[model samples]
Target: MTSKHSLRNPKDMQYAFSYFYYLIHKKVPFDLDKLWAKEIDINRDGYLNENELRTLAINVFSTPLKPTTFKEFKSDLYKTCMELRHPTPAPVIVEESSSSDSSDSSSSSSESSEDSGSTAAVPVIPATQTATATAVATATATVTATTAPKATTPAVDNNTLEVGQKELEACRIDLEVLKASNKTLMEIHKSYAKRTMYRTSIEGTDEVAFLMVDDNDNSTQTKLDGVRQRRHKFICLNDNINHDKPTAHLVIKVIHDFYESLFPFPSSFELPPGQTNHFRYIHEIIDKKQEENNKNNTFIYIFGVVGVMIVMLMWKRSKRSSNGNHHSINGIIGGVGNKSAAKQRSNKRYMIV
Candidate 1:
């Protein structure tokens, strides 16, 4: 609201509303000074006033903000203002001393508008003006004094307190809607992560998976973005799994390959110092392969040992038999040398060649 400055920026209203949200969130109450600093919402150095405030509330309170964009916020504002102009009377309960008064109130409301009110089964307000309504909410003493300032606004009819209560209820509804929407968006992100994850057995890129190294010298080995290590999502299609998504699969594969090229795993992987979970997932896959290889090597070693032991046993047995036969033949030659006369008679009869 700085004297307009001859610069017509309609988006100013949008920025003001966002700051209004920021301040209210900090639990810092608003006043004129805050507007000067541009921390508070202003329509030329005054609080957006009750009317404008209500308009803002309606937009903020209605259908959930998807992505919470400025455009969405402005759209909500317009919608709320339109709705405030024509309010539907909710079926409200008011402890009344008499039934006739209630009838008079209902008749007045019907006559005031042509729409016949909505049949949405809303709660009805018992009091028509704010003064009496304040009396019920507070103690018995302050109703008359409080009702004076409210006389200017028509919404502060005989059931001013009731109307205030209704406004409060609307505000509560808006709060609930925002909270629920935030939860929904968070859930959607998680769902997206699970379906497109390259967490297991894919081998390289998603194999060792992707990593990110920021200026802080911190490394993220499992995800492309350091911030979302738990659930990283990319668009990929598996033609083998789904026939219609071949193109989708091709697009994703290209991205995966490109990402892997950027953050290839070195011979040794240590996901910096602090990145435990991502490191752990990669480590698990690596550890499984190592364990399998170790098991195979161990089996080979055991077999080689057994084969060597059997060969050694056979060689020892053959050497022992050869030595025994050689000793027996030598013993026969020594005994025959002493019997020469018998040997000569044997040679004559046999005609030795």
Candidate 2:
């Protein structure tokens, strides 16, 4: 059976008493009820009174009383029990009639005492009422003090205000100057973009595209159509030029140098012997000859030789026929010469006869 001073269940009461006892003494006692009766039960009537129950509640919910589990349930139970057992204090009301009567009697007594030239007797207020009044006055003063606005410092002087305005104006001037500078810088950037061109990478090739900037500072990118020549120029001129890669500027320089080397100015202008070997003309002629050699075929050479022999044989036959005709004419003339000699000899014989 639970004791009259205990909670609803004997086990819970024992635990509660033991918990509170440990909180107060910092050690669990052998008998929780004996400790509770000795320390908490002020009247020792074997029952917990209002004060004892409030004390027990405070101990149970004290800051150091940290329960490891069921913390929410313990807090709720504690709050519920505290609300049931220790309700809020009701508002105190003094009788207006009694207060007015006391004030009037005090005033009359003070007037009589003052007329008699005696020290005005002090009004004897009850100790409890005086304490309550003092407490109420203190609370009212604290509330008013907290809610009231703090006294501010005096307004800034004219000199300080003038100085601050001057500083603000200087800052505004600086900001305007910065804005103007920024505008000028943007204009310079626009001009630079219009004058400059960029070379960007091309996909699936080691080649790059040249992006030309227009008058409006807009870019137009185009892939180099003749990449082979440009690549050759890049290989040849990369060592001589400062650029690491082929750009429009570098390509232009290469083309200019190549043209100058091929058809120099003044028509008779010649490069130094050392620089002449770097020109492409010699390399181009050598490459053409190599290409022709690579394209040469045995059958074509044989056909050319046969055609040359046939033409030579036809020329020889025509020459031999003409020679034979000339020799026959000469023999006929010799025969005529023999006949003329005979006719001359016969004339001589006739002359002799």
Candidate 3:
């Protein structure tokens, strides 16, 4: 490929490349062949040289080229090259100066008279060239102003901003509801913690009675009058209750309702022997499951320790074997050296004898 630095003008190359790109995408509004010939073939040679084509390929279309697309590009380029073999003639531009000649002559005469009276000399300029230069400068300035890129700030939509604010407000409302729910749950827990249960004898009767009291305040007390009355105590207390402002009575009622739902009161004031045994059975089952889990965990710990010990024993055995082999090799080498020295001394004594 030709180097980008070798190209005479990068702007012309970019423009020509844009035309080529438009042609490839089938977006050219004008004749592709005519545009390519006019813009790319700067010397009117009617042909794009290797250097020009390489510049277009490297600078303009510098992407990974697919084989099929590249083949299509080469085919279109070949057809355009064959069709535009002959150079077209340049258009002639004629400037008419006859209408302004009289005005120019009068102005020149006045300027000449002024120059003759003055001491300094001024250079004469052609009116026609000055007018042409002014028009060219104005056209260049207009084209530059139009083509130059403008710096723009991205616009933010008010509708999207409003939607975001609405979503944020909804999230805040949800957070408040969650906080209120948490506070209610905490109040329920505190009410349960302050409850007290005990058995007491009525003043004149031999019968014992159970009383459920709320220790949160001294105003509220609940008494189980008799065995028949125990069943409906929770129900009667929960009826006609207001929970919005949980006073001492309301708190006691809520706690009693929560406890009775889990464990209903027995028919007698004293708990039945069967019910007591059932509770003991449940506790024993939980303790047994917990003991089994602890045993399994202990077995796993011992097995891991044994595995580590076995590995360490194997490593020590291998190290001892290697050390024994190295010592044997050193001893064999030392014995061979001593044997050779003894043989050399015996030969030397025999030669002296």
Candidate 2 lDDT tens digits, 238-330 = 222324443546555545554565446544566555564444567886987787876686668888999999999999999999999999999
Q: What is candidate 3's lDDT per residue for 163-255, written digit by digit as tens?
A: 223332332222122123343234323433332333322243334334444443333333322333544323223132344545746565645
**Best-to-worst TM-score order:** 1, 3, 2
Residue 34, candidate 2: Cα error in Å is 99
Give all TM-scores, in the order shown.
0.21, 0.18, 0.21
Candidate 2 or 3, higher lDDT?
3
lDDT of each: 0.46, 0.47, 0.49
Ranking by lDDT: 3, 2, 1
Candidate 1 residue spans exceeding 4 A from truth: 1-244, 249-301, 331-341, 344-353
Candidate number with the higher lDDT (1 or 2): 2
Candidate 3, position 267, lDDT: 62
RMSD of 3: 33.7
Candidate 3: stretches off by over 4 Å = 1-283
